[model samples]
Target: MFCPHKNSYLQLVCAVNPRIINKAVDQAMQREHFDPHTELPPAQRLESMQPSLYAPHVDITRAQLGFGRIGLRLINRALHSHDNLVQLQALHSVLDQVQISENAMFLINLQLIYRIIDLMLDQDPIIKEKVCLILSRLATYYQGRRRIMSRPVIVENLMRLIMRDRKEIRYAASYTLKTLARDRCACKIIMQNEQVVEDLLKMVKSDHTGIVVLHLATLTNLAEWDLTRALKANAFQIMLTLFENKDPRIVSGAMNCMSQLCKHDVGKVLADDYDLTFVLRRFLKSSQIEVIISATGLMCYTTLTTRSKWRAKESCNELTKLLVNLCCTPNLPLLQIRCMQVLINLCDSPDIRHHMKVYWEKKVKTINVRTHEEWDGTSETSSYGLETAHNYRTMCIEKVETIKNDFGDNAQVVNVHSYLRRIREVKEHLLQAINWKSYKN
Candidate 1:
């Protein structure tokens, strides 16, 4: 029988009916009929009997009673309960079954959100961790995000959790913060907290790669909201140092953060730093595709500066080779595009342009000739080879065409073109002055 206090009734029944529980357990054991020679362990016997004893209370028809309503009731009771374990179980059950609509309703009921936020400060790490997870899930929806951001205390609590010594709590806090940071309102609130950036910087410096990556993601979103905070936190330097880490995830996280930071003035300064250039160059050779993509992207942004152009010219041979290899490969279209852009920037240096020209002439011509011959005449077995070669050549040509069009259409390339043109004009003016002096002498 269901009542307004159904959960409380169930709890009271379990507490007051020890004889009824024993009778149900005895019936379950008699039904199983265990052998007299074999004795079941007390723990196993209790576990086997638990379901039968609790079945009456646990079984509820969804048609007669809404599961969502029942789950909310349990959570509501658990919120005010003194037992931490019971509170955790109740919250976990509700979160596991609560739909988006139910979650929206929960947010509308401000007290529920307040209770969850209050639980975040609980002494038990498990309760705090679960609370963070619930908050993280709720933060995924816009309304839920707005609700969480509405309470400044929630953000303040999360910031403190991020700084805690416990790894699990830190991870949970970081994840929740990452989701929260995606919303502009929440991000603005987080950015206003001065300790947010400082705490993230500390996590980035941590030896644990997982913690560093989570914090990096949170910082990335925060940077999107306000880059000045990131710059003030020395995020550029932290990311540059993280670039050398052996973990691909750490490298990738650092590169992604650097990519976002590079859009700011401080990022431009960091990009032009000689040490940062050395790190980017080293990362270009990384075996991981993600590492290469992020590294090359950062390299492209760095080359936007005139000083970085000269610096890029010094690595012309290596970069040209890297570009050619990427361009020839069909799978990495985005990387190839970025590499081409970098090459276009390096073209301002005549020496680098000459090196690229020579390399392309030799390599492209040889590959084209071989592929053309293979396509023209092919045996049955050679047909497959011919097709492969044809596809390769086609991709290579398309890449070249794409690069050329990008050069024409790209605004960045237009800037590089103007810089080169200005240098040429200056050289011509000097040449004219020298010729005039010769005639006067």
Candidate 2:
């Protein structure tokens, strides 16, 4: 193809003739299905389709031979083409032949990515799939990840893709962002990007597998920017919801990210903003141990930070109870270490220290009685000399008095009694395990 310039008549030539290109593509397609992952012809048969790289020596247009401008033009033309297949082919060619330098980003040619993004509005499932792959590849590309992020238009495009009704596209975009956010600088760029947080927040309720993954990825990246503040801003609710997902990886990632985000100056603010005492109360009983552990660690850290910055309040006592309960659970040394660290940090406050110790003492007594009952083959009722067991035994008897004074008994008692029961059980289990070891000696 030739676009004539001046009297010099700049000649532009495509390496592959159109007819042969089609024929070769057809044969390649017949041999193997079209795979977007395959950048070029199959590696085994590269010898037959030895493609040459083209760098124009003479000015094809008005300006010098800048690789950036040429790449944009090629990418744009590929995006605008009415044929999806042709667009795919063009995208493949650009990704294959374009020489991206170190530290440079795909944003250098943002317009092309924008052009492809515009096509996302189309309803074709196949095209959307290809677009997902293209966006994903661009996001993960060494320099390309940064390049795509630099342009607001590209972020808008990605946000739109993420919000798409299709699950596959949503997952693809989420996965792409997750990969990109692995880079610390890239995460900061994403956090500062226009509407990234808002768009991500909206994805919180999405049922798609990819969107959930994407939400965690986006929050993970945002936390890296200023984890404490980012989470306090609104990620807490979404992260809490993600904690409900069955995928262990997502649960683990969300927990770890939430933990890091809560480690900053606003850590206490985040805990208070989310009213984590209530949230963790529920998460403590989560079926997934990883979720339980992470939730526990986050609570411990949040309480530790809040004690230092915020005014002393009953909230600290609630946090103490939560941590003491966590300490009563059995787990990896790392989790116990974190729980212990929380205990040490919280020790600075006499009230928290006392409250935690009281909770620990009660937990120990409960465990000791239960173990004797179990070993003696005596029922709990007879062993404890109680006619009836009541729920909410772990709840601070002082909690209701405080609430009654603060908000009158008219305030409906949030039935946190269940959480208390679970925590008591966890404490008993840990205590039993530890006591068994001492008796053996």
Candidate 3:
């Protein structure tokens, strides 16, 4: 039994039976209904029903209910409310409903971005943290990122928050900054501020792995825009330090940042100062596929850089083993391709080529012996066993024949010599793909 004026009835309920209204609001805000598919509790359901009575006239209902303008008004009012509890509740309410597209659009349209940034200065750490969370959600979209970046003071405020002693505030600020850095213009704006880079470097040096991961991600995006700045800030060395961190997430983020840095000849820096070959070889054992992939990629770049060749050659045995294992491993196409590229680069050195040849020869022989044993045993057994043995033999024969084609008539040398030629051809094709000019020294 609801009144004709739904908003008025709700307001009347709030005034007359404030406890009942608060209880209903509390139930509605419970975490159980957080999922979209979950049904609300009966009281919350009743509150939701009050809005449906006027749903037939959608636009008129939205306007008359003031869901658009009033929600923002409430937030504004609560933001400036004298009571800290009221301020926290108001911000939390806006945050709770932010997942709804209409409410998010309303907040964005009302230009609450600036107001939320101002709220970041709230003396209460909880209020500051909540505001940062709101900003993080808002920065998830392109328009929000553009709007947030429009005001330079907002970026400065975020940087200040990043340096705050409170881990929660620093984390929220770092996350929001990471999201904002996704936009090219926003990334440029962030990188232009020298203190942002400095503050990020300081965080990287801090003992906190979680905060370090976020700052590393933000720096990764920033590095993508300007590798020189990243290098100047000693990002490469910092990432190298993170590589040794025990946390897999921090290690992965560092690897990703190193990979991006290597894209701009920062590999030269990695090659010169760090034992990248040893580092990458160690990473080959990582259980994480992403870490393995990133390591392989940086290994490829490090080996390709002129100064790193000596180090690459020194790790020829390890590199060759890594490549062979990746090649034989099933279901990892990306890792296989990247390993192959690095293998091709390493093949330029005679020592690496020799090591690879020995490695392949050993693999071929091992497979050949196994196939022969199976063939011998299958002849006196069932038809099924014979068929299996025949298939195995055929596969081995094809592999040997493929090697023979490249190495000519010498079967003993075929595996290694053929592999050398194949890798050279792959390198040539890769160079041609990128239209790289060859210089005669």
Alpha-carbon shift of residue 323 in model 2 (angstroms): 6.7
Per-model TM against the reference:
0.65, 0.48, 0.65
lDDT tens readout by residue for model 3, 1-441? 222223444444343444445455657677344322122322232454443222121222111123656756777656677766666667777777667777787778778787778888877777788788888898876667778888878888888888864876888888889888867789888876877876788888874777888888888888888888778777888888888887777887888788777877655666666878777788898876667876887777777765566777776676677766765532343455567687667666656666656555455223211222222322112212322222211112346667678776676532333433444455344333233224555
lDDT of each: 0.63, 0.55, 0.66
lDDT of 1 at 139: 78
lDDT of 2: 0.55
- Residues 1-441 of candidate 1 have per-residue lDDT tens digits of 221122333534454443344446657778566333223322223223222212233333121214556646655666678865566566666566445676556644745666788788888776788778878888777677777787888877987887764877787888888888767678888787768887788868864667787788778778877888788888888887787788887888788888889888778887776445556777778777778777877776777777876776777777777765664542433455565566656665666666656565454222211122223322111212322322221101234356667666553332223433443443333223222321353
In model 3, the Cα lDDT at residue 375 comes to 23
How far residue 8's Cα lies from its native spot in candidate 3, in Å, is 37
- Per-residue lDDT of candidate 2, residues 1-441 (tens digit): 221221112232554433355446667668656433233333233332332222234223122223655655555565677765556555555444344433124433555566656666666554565555666666655556655666646555667777765666667667767766666677666666656776776776665654675576567666766654565457666666776677765776577667766677665666666666565656666666566666667766676654342443456665556555655543232344455555556555556555555556555454221221222322113212533433221222345668778899796453334333444555444444333322353
